[model samples]
Structure formats: C-alpha cells, structure tokens
Target: VLRGQRPDARVIEAVRGVTFDVAVGESVGVIGPNGSGKTSLLQATTGLLPLAGGQVLVRSIPAFLGVQA
Candidate 1:
C-alpha cells in the first residue's frame, strides 16, 4: 500500500507488519532472497513508497541514490 494518494488501481502489498529501530550508532542490514520484500522495505522506510500501515519516524530525511549501470 503506497502512502498518501490513493491509487486508482488495484493494490499489491509487498511488505507487511515490519517493525524495527536504529540508534545513532547502530547499523542494521536487511537480507533476504529474491522476492522477499527487501526492496519494498527500504522504499517504504525512505519515503519513496507509501506505507500501508504503521508509522516511520526518521531523525533526518533519507536520500535515495539509484543503482547505476
């Protein structure tokens, strides 16, 4: 579920009920095989994608750098 604007089409849920926290000095990694919601989680967290449920609070805005060829 993408966040703000409601889509005029069908919805596909990629990630669900994912929760976690990171401290100032903590480093977290997301690991999973293909089609395991890894990219979805990052997109939702960084505000590139809207969240269907729950909330995300970040100390600073996230910057998304595309993977270059």
Candidate 2:
C-alpha cells in the first residue's frame, strides 16, 4: 500500500525510478514537457511527496522557497 492507500488501486506515477547525483556547488536543472514529472521529481526529492519505491538521498535537507513572497 502507498500512503495508506491500497496497493492494487489505480494510481498515477508522477515519477518513477529516477536517479541522479549532484556534487556540492554543482549546477543542474529539471526540464521537461508538460505533465512529464519535473515538479513531481522535485517534490519527491525534497520530501514534499511520498516515494512509492526506490530511494532519495541528499547531503542535507532541502528547503522549498517559492517565488511568491
């Protein structure tokens, strides 16, 4: 089961099996077409979204600073 939901239930996989690494001070960008999971990947990486499988490791906790405000 995922997030208290049934395993057999239909669900949308916004992101799946994504893997990568970024060294300190390295620059990176997440680019994709609409509904291609760019935001989902970022959310999963920063713990905003629960991961269904695989793992996410970071040197430190991520902070989400929105443009607004």
Candidate 3:
C-alpha cells in the first residue's frame, strides 16, 4: 500500500423528498422527466439499493428485474 494516501469516498444524490401511498386494490404510477430518478426511487422501495435514509412499508416482498446502465 502507498504511504500517506487517502481513498476515494464519493456519493451521489438520486431521489429525495418523495412521499405517497396506495389503498388496497388501487393502482398507481410514477412519472417524471428522464434522469429524474424515477427508477432510483423504485429501487430503494424494493430493496435493490440501500437507502441512505428513509423507510419503506410494504405488504409483501418486492420483485426486481433491474437492468444495468
């Protein structure tokens, strides 16, 4: 290892300040402009990504089939 060196610690902000709910048997949708983090919000709710903060409540396990960029 190199002496007196620091590692890179970078972070990105995807989604923020989002809140909503759906009633039983109700339908819902998420819409936004491209690169607006529609997918990132979904990922956090489904557990595909670790949430830096906040919480997700669900009646059942989520299904994920995410594609790589």
List model 1 lDDT by residue over 1-69, tens digit each: 453454575566778787687897999999999988898788766667765666666655443333311
Best-to-worst lDDT order:
1, 2, 3
| TM-score on alpha carbons, each prediction | 0.65, 0.66, 0.65
Against the true structure, candidate 1 reaches a TM-score of 0.65
Where does candidate 1 stray beyond 4 Å? 3-8, 59-69
lDDT, candidate 3, 1-69, per-residue tens: 011123554445778788787788999888989988887787776666666566666544333344321
What lDDT does candidate 3 reach at residue 45? Answer: 64
lDDT of each: 0.67, 0.64, 0.62
Q: Single out the weakest 10-residue window by summed lDDT for candidate 2.
A: 60-69
lDDT of 2 by residue, 1-69 (tens): 123356676657777667687887999999999989887777666666566676666554444323211
